[model samples]
Target: MDPAAEAARRLEADPSMLLCGPLSVLHAVLDVVVRAYGEAAETVRAALDRLEDRVLAALACRPHRGHPLPGARGP
Candidate 1:
């Protein structure tokens, strides 16, 4: 089963836990949201790092390399 579904099932098994009032519920949801945001930011950072490494490698290996790379000139 999916992890989200499993979490939902666990929550459903204890419906009373949902009665912890608005503040508690709001905190729980915000905690999850913040954690997910952090995970996403890390994923994006890793991807961008990889892209930067690749671009640097390509530039270093290019023959007749010049400053300011292709298409980087100001209008």
Candidate 2:
């Protein structure tokens, strides 16, 4: 569930949260937000890793160029 909904559910399910003060509520919300961000970051990192692996594999399959004379002072 989304952070707001989760926080609301927590508050409703546990009335003591309201008596703890606003900071407690804020902490609960922030905790959810932080966890969501961490999950998203991990997803992105895994995708990038897969992409890098594919690129490296493709490059490894290609033949190397033996000639280079575009702007060289060849002997």
Candidate 3:
């Protein structure tokens, strides 16, 4: 399941979560949020890495060019 849904399910499944006091409940919620953020960051990093590899590969396959004026003669 997705992170948000999973986090909610976890919070809901544990009835004791509410009895732990505001601070403890807050900590649990924050922990879930942080984990979700970390997962999202990893996904973004992987996508960027794939994009960079494709761009580099395309550049590598391009033909090299010589100097533009190599064949020019004095006017």
Measured by lDDT, the strongest candidate is 2
Candidate numbers, best TM-score first, in rank order: 2, 3, 1
Model 3, which residues run further than 4 Å from truth? 1-20, 66-75
Candidate 3, backbone clash total: 0
C-alpha local distance difference test of each model: 0.70, 0.89, 0.77
lDDT of 2 by residue, 1-75 (tens): 689888888888888888879987897898889999999999999999999999999999999877977998778
Model 1: how far residue 55 lies from native, Å? 0.2
Evaluate model 2: give its lDDT. Answer: 0.89
Q: What number of backbone clashes does candidate 1 have, counting pairs of residues 3 or more apart or in separate chains? A: 0
TM-score of each: 0.57, 0.73, 0.61
Pairs clashing within candidate 1: none
- What would the per-residue lDDT of candidate 1 be over residues 1-75, giving only the tens digit for each residue? 344554455457767757776654555556566777898899999999999999999988979744686779755
Per candidate, the number of residue pairs that clash is 0, 0, 0
TM-score of 1: 0.57
Least accurate 10 contiguous residues by lDDT in model 2: 65-74
Q: Least accurate stretch of 10 residues (summed lDDT) in model 3?
A: 1-10
